[model samples]
Target: MLAAMRTFELSPADRFTFAQRAAVLSAAYADYFVPLWVNAQQMEAMDQIYDVDARRSVVAHAGREPIGMALLSLRGPRGWISAVGVIPAWRRRGAARAMLRRLLENAAQLGLDEVWLEVIEENAPAAALYRELGFSAARELLTWRYPADGDLLPIPRELLQPAPVERALAHFAAWHGQPPSWQREEPTLRHLAARSSAYELWMEDALAGYCVVGERPDAISILDIGLNPDFGPVKAGRTLLQALAHRFRGRAFTMINVPADDDLSRALAALRFTVTIRQWEMRLPIIAR
Candidate 1:
């Protein structure tokens, strides 16, 4: 099986065909959660200058037919397993494992300190596979579908004024609280700067909390939110959330990858947020060969 799998490093933006990539993703995730449908706009967005380096995306071909792929996002000492897929016909033939192994070897060669990925909490088989490959459970992340209407009474606009993107980004950089998953991490936020809107919550002259939300088309994705660790996560989360709730009144939203045990979860619970799904962030440390 391994002999039939010819691996090729793909520079997706330059050489690989999008339709082929999309086909593999769809087939691999046939029974998986929300199978990917890579639309034209999404493809254009992917081509934009994000932290992702196309050369790290690997494709496995069985006699010129793409059967598996693994997408990587490089961030200096940190690397992310953004995606991994194996078509239905390739499953159980060791295609997924082979593709992953090749990616890991290449990641190590790139001198990354650690490589990380997230798996659905209920996916026992995938989790076990990752553990066997040296990945360890790091933290539980929650995906919440929050539709609760917050206090309708208006608050001081000054308290939740628009903040400088750099200011919010700096606060994000300085945060020492719960470790964030890929979507909420600094690299993703930095890459999304231009399209995301930023805001900071304040108490008098002190900055208490901040958030970055996706604008327009995807107004529901709360990309990142945080507060001063010393100020208290629960209080700040509520305050910040309240501001957001009022700002986006009657509009529904979904937040992803929030630490399950953190104070923010308590705040979310108080707001009647429902857990849509849960995921586990897995980490693997690397030593160059």
Candidate 2:
């Protein structure tokens, strides 16, 4: 029988210091599908990249123990539910729902025009919950992986030139075929450039594309890549990926949350990259535009 009045309680995450909140999130996501194990330092870095607003986020407590957390990131009139997770023992106990409800309430109070989030396609329960909260899937995002030993495509490196990360981002919107995910947005890319390498492609004296790569302990991620449509996105993307493969040989590569309908996926497929995970980008409109 269920215990009477036994339920998770919501608290403003800002009540805790950054390090304490990071520890809470780390524990909550310890057994997640992707299994993130970020320390306070890493969490701080992520907060900067995601524009997280701790004051607008929430933590779920069972008694005095933080058993779950949900982060909210605000960018102008838009708010993103960056993450929502609960410890294994606390699953299906109303923690996630409580945290999410609190975040939505916070966003609405902040006068956000819309709120966004992504849910792994295979996680039916999470998807359903977001839908129940009035979120609608806007698009499908794909995570692509390339094996370390995969055959590298034959492409000339003559036109590929090393460049400042800012140079690449200067043309981001113009070169990209579709809108980017929040993680790949311009502000996030700028923050990530401190730890990444950037390069650009030139075709007939014109800038054809740009690519930025960020290395992890076990893999190299394509943090951002943009191909000018006028120059043939697939062709330009192939050259860019080939350059990345040659530059970082013997390292597995991952590119997360690329829109499924993006033209760049063709180049990825041609270069032996395969989809590893699919996610749905969902949004809840709070204020009419």
Candidate 3:
């Protein structure tokens, strides 16, 4: 007979070590071969963005061996499902369902207004599970990427002047044609301030386009870029991509979760950036029970 499954919360005293947590996630995603895997340090950095609470993140065990886990983030009334996974050996068990139900209950208890997450567009089973749990499609997000080919030199830096990081961040929020997806929100960029910077190219001192980039130990990630929507996407897109390529030339970068059909997306494509991945942002309104 299979051992009885039980769950427990993470804690500040470090009841569950970071290595242990990383191991569970790595095993849960062991079959995936692309983009390498997330290490303990990377997980730590990511957890900070969600304001992860140990008491709220759940770990499941079948007789002391971890079989599944659900990591949650609580920011005000917004609860984000940062990640959820079950080890291969434990697949088809009810652990994922049980853990999510527990997580939603926890969120409701805290009086959260809503919960959110992203599911890969091709992951049908996972999407179905989230849908069954009351998640609705919020928006489609796309990841655009390009290798900084040494052969492709950037235009002179004089063409794109470095902008004040703080001021530009503010301008980005003000210029958004639509509300930004959670990962691309200003708060995320600010929280990651230690390793990030922003730049702007002006059409005579007013903002033409601007981009934010962050440098982690292992990844040089593009957070987001904002261009004047009034100028039209193709033109704004061209200017922004060229300016970005010039600024961060020779170093491959991946921009995460930009609106799929917007001007930015078109610009990335026109610049030959490839779609590395796509995800559906899903949301759940937490009605207190």
Candidate 4:
């Protein structure tokens, strides 16, 4: 059986064709909770933003044809299993398990102490797989979206002004109550700054909050937003969103991985940004080689 002869190998981005990896990912995620599609260009961008380590990632093959791929991102002693997918037709044949085992081994080889990944709250099979591999659920993360059709309520122009990216990040630690997810980490935001824009909210001439957004081909993303603890979260959040809406009129917006209990989450709800999905961050300790 072809399934019996399946194999897995490291396919560094430099040595592998991203087009092939992107095709497998698109096919593998066809039935995902949210629609996801990517081309090689986006893959390359992700490679840079996510800090993907080519040598540690894995590709699964069934008799020499690519069936799945997994990417690993390294940050000092930690590893992030950023993406994993096996094409639909080849699922249930141990491809995912084999690929993950290879990735864990790779992590061990690199002296990483832990590896992290996220699974949709409703994805039992994937969650079970992670648990079986010694992962533990960490925390809940929420995805929020606001449609572009609604009236853009006017914000006080003097209170909300365009900001340089560095200015927007000036109060990052004071603004967010919890550490951001891997994608929104300071380093990643800096990596994406070239393609993103920012806005700062002022209260009585004092900087109260700020937000960074990057326009995707489909919708604008609220990459990061933070409010000074001295200000009311809802008011600060509302002003930020209104300013953003006015600046990028007619573009829908999405914010991913906000902590479930975050004030930002509440602020988004108050403004009618519906929850699109919920996910659980998971982590596994890796035994060094």
RMSDs, each prediction? 3.8, 2.4, 3.3, 2.6
Q: If both were scored by TM-score, which would come out higher, candidate 3 or candidate 4?
A: 4
Question: Per-model C-alpha lDDT, please?
Answer: 0.74, 0.85, 0.74, 0.83
Clashes of 2: 0
> Which candidate, 2 or 4, would have the higher lDDT against the true structure?
2
**Can you give the TM-score per candidate against the true fold?**
0.85, 0.94, 0.86, 0.90
Model 2 per-residue lDDT tens digits across residues 214-280: 8776689899998888889998888878877777778899999999988898889887799999999
Error of 4 at 274 (Å): 0.4
lDDT of 2: 0.85
Q: For residues 1-289, what per-residue lDDT tens digits would candidate 4 score against the true structure?
A: 6456645444543456878778777878888887578999887888899999867788776655677888899889989999889877678888788888888988888889999999998899999999999999988999998887866667546445788898788778778888899998888888988888888878877888998988765579999998888888877887777777777778899999998988888888877889899999998988722
Ranking by lDDT: 2, 4, 3, 1
> Which of the numbered candidates is closest to the native, going by highest lDDT?
2
Model 4: CA > 4 A from native: 1-14, 151-159, 216-218, 287-289
- At residue 178, candidate 4 shows an lDDT of 86
lDDT of 1 by residue, 84-183 (tens): 8877666776666766787788788888899989999888888988888899999899998766453453443545778767679897766637767777
Model 1 spans > 4 angstroms off: 1-15, 44-50, 148-159, 217-219
